[model samples]
Each structure stands twice: as C-alpha cells, then as structure tokens.
Target: MLSIPTFPETDHQIVRSLASYSDRELVSLHQLHPEQGKFFAALFCRYGAIVHSVVQHAVESQLQADYLFAIAWRQIFGELHRVKLAADPEATNWQNWLIDITGNTIAQIEVPPSAQIRYTLNTAPPPLWCYLERGLDLLPPLSRLIVVMTQSLKWKDRRISAYLQGEGQQIPPDSIPNYLIAGYQQLEAAVPQDIREIYQSGIGKQADALN
Candidate 1:
C-alpha cells in the first residue's frame, strides 16, 4: 500500500492542501465544479489502506475482498460530495468520518455460502429463523410489508407507521414483530429442510451487510 503521510505536517502536498480546506470549502468545490478527480485522488491516498483493511475483514477471501473494495470505491465516487459537505469534515476528527464510511462499507458485504451465521438447532434441520425469512414471500400482504420495512429496510417505526397509515391500516410498533412471527410460523410449516438453511443464511448475511 502507498503511504501518504497524515495531514498538517505530511510530505503529501495534497494532504496539506486539504487540511486547510474546510468541509464547506471541499463541499462547495465539489458542488460548484465539474468533477472531483484530484480531490478524490488525495482522499484515496490518505485512506485507501484503511478502506482495504475494512473490506478484507468482512470478506476474508482475497478475490471477494477485492470485489468489495471496488464496490466501496464506486460508492465513494458516487457519494463523495455528500461526505465532504457533511456537518464536520474540517474538524480534527475528520478521519472518524472516513472510518465510519469504511466500516459501513464492510458491514454491507455478503458472507459466502459456506457461512451460516446464526445458531443451528439440530443436525437434522436448521434453525427456525432460516425458514422464517424464506416464508417472507408467502406472508400476508400487510404483514410482509411490516416485516420487510422494519427488518430488511431498517426503517424507523414512525416512518413505518406513516406508511401503514397511508395503506389504510394502522399498526403500532409493538405489533410489528407479531406480524412477522405469524408469517414465519406459517412459512416454517411449508418449507423444505434444505431450503430453510439457505434462507436463514441469506437473511443473516443480508442483515450483516447492513451493519
């Protein structure tokens, strides 16, 4: 990995240049300009290793890690403007923001097929949660809606409530799990043992991807 010295006293002039540029300055520059080729290059030099470490930790496989790193790089390009303009980019704690970005990127990785992240119940069959997620497709319309919004999308209860209200049925936050649970139970009755394993593993990794 290339070493670009940390800002303030770093031999990297781009680092020094950005160190003096406020978050607003960087944001405005990005917003008011045609592109951020040079600006992003400086940031990549400054934190590329940190980002690589993050992706490597999640994927463990070199090939997959490289793929995930490429995905993160693309995200940085797409979202760079938002990050630079974020509330406190100029502060000394700027690296924290970068770390947060990298960490979020890591969480979004899909664990491979061999990994079943949740606890298994028995050798004869997989855990209950495995069947539950698979059953998601068969659930009652409103129940499936609640579970997907609350669990998969991770939306706040208030937003979910509003959405439900728009659908002409109101449900409290406390009842969300019940709806999901009932849906899962029905799904369990119908799923094959092997199918349950795959469903459970996929959802767990999907949730991890959100971490």
Candidate 2:
C-alpha cells in the first residue's frame, strides 16, 4: 500500500511541497480551500502545458491560442468544484476531465475575424519550441519531470533517482532510462511532423534559444 505523506503547515511550504502529490490530493486541497490560489496553482503547473497545447492545436495564431488559454483556465477554475471522484480504483481521471473542459471551452470560443486576418498576414506560426513545449506537456507527469530534469536542468539519472526516492517515488537509476526513452518517444510523436523537421534541420539552436 502507498503511504500518505504529510503536508507542511503553512500555505507557502505546502505549495512548494506539492510536487510529490497525486492529482486527486491536489484537487481535494483546492476544494478544501477554494479561496486559496496556491492549491489550484499546483494543478496548473502539472497540466497547464497540456491545456495550452490543446488550444494551440485548435487555433491558427498564438494570439488566438493565448486568448483561448486564459478563457479555458478561467472556466476550469470556476468549475473545479464539480469534479468528484469515488474511492474506488475506477474513479474519475482528473487529467481527462481537465482536457474535456479545455476542449469545451475552446469549442465555445469563436476567434475574431479581425485578429485572425491580422495574425495570418503579419505573424508567422509560433516558434518550433512552442510545439516542443506542448509535446513535453503531453507526457505523463513523472516522465515529463524526469525529462526536464535530465535535459533542461542537466541532472543525471542517479540524481533524478535520489530526488524521486526522497519524494517517496521508488524509481531506481537503472529504470530511469526506460522513462526517458518512453518520454522521448511520446514527445516526438506528439509534436507535428513539419515542426519536427524544421527543428531537426539545423534551426534547433535558434529554437532552443527561444526558450
């Protein structure tokens, strides 16, 4: 059986300490303190990229994507209390639920014709890094975290294993590569083919610099 970890006493500490929490626990904390943005912020950090990616895929311009992303999150914040889960293993999946809300929000929003034309004529598609960002968001939480630590933070597998173990996740250093392989595969698959081509064709330095 998995043991429940105790949260820190203060809101700030709790916020910083939420990296190891499950989605259900985070939602429950939000429900308990709806007045506190910190709880919801944890959820946002965990899945905000996925929400942004969904909006980006739906719209043509970054302007439109940004507009819809804000609206989607506003709707999500207001409706979060409606999310309920049973105690059983087959209970509601919070990630799927959040995705559904994002999709619905985007569907309800009609992009302005003026903005569409303005962006179409003046602005190029967002940098390739944006798609890569979205691809990382599409990964499972642990996989995403490992990839970010390894690639962005330059942490080795042993260090990542130690960090996870400290956080009550028992993944060993040897198994870390499997997670990286799976994460890389999912990331490549999630990004658009054209974007991948552009990124791989020697513009990657510029793209990485954009981040």
Candidate with maximal lDDT: 2
Instruction: Mark the 10 consecutive residues where model 1 has the least summed lDDT.
Output: 119-128
**Which lDDT tens digits does candidate 2 get at residues 51-132?**
7778777776565665566567667876887788654546758878899999998788887743433232011123234445
Clashing residue pairs in candidate 1 are: 107-209, 108-209, 130-200
Candidate 1's displacement at residue 154, Å, is 37
All candidates: TM-score:
0.37, 0.46
Judge candidate 2 against the unseen true structure and give its global Cα lDDT, from 0 to 1.
0.63
- The TM-score between candidate 1 and the true structure equals 0.37
How many steric overlaps does candidate 2 have? 0
Model 2 scores worst on lDDT over the 10 consecutive residues at 1-10
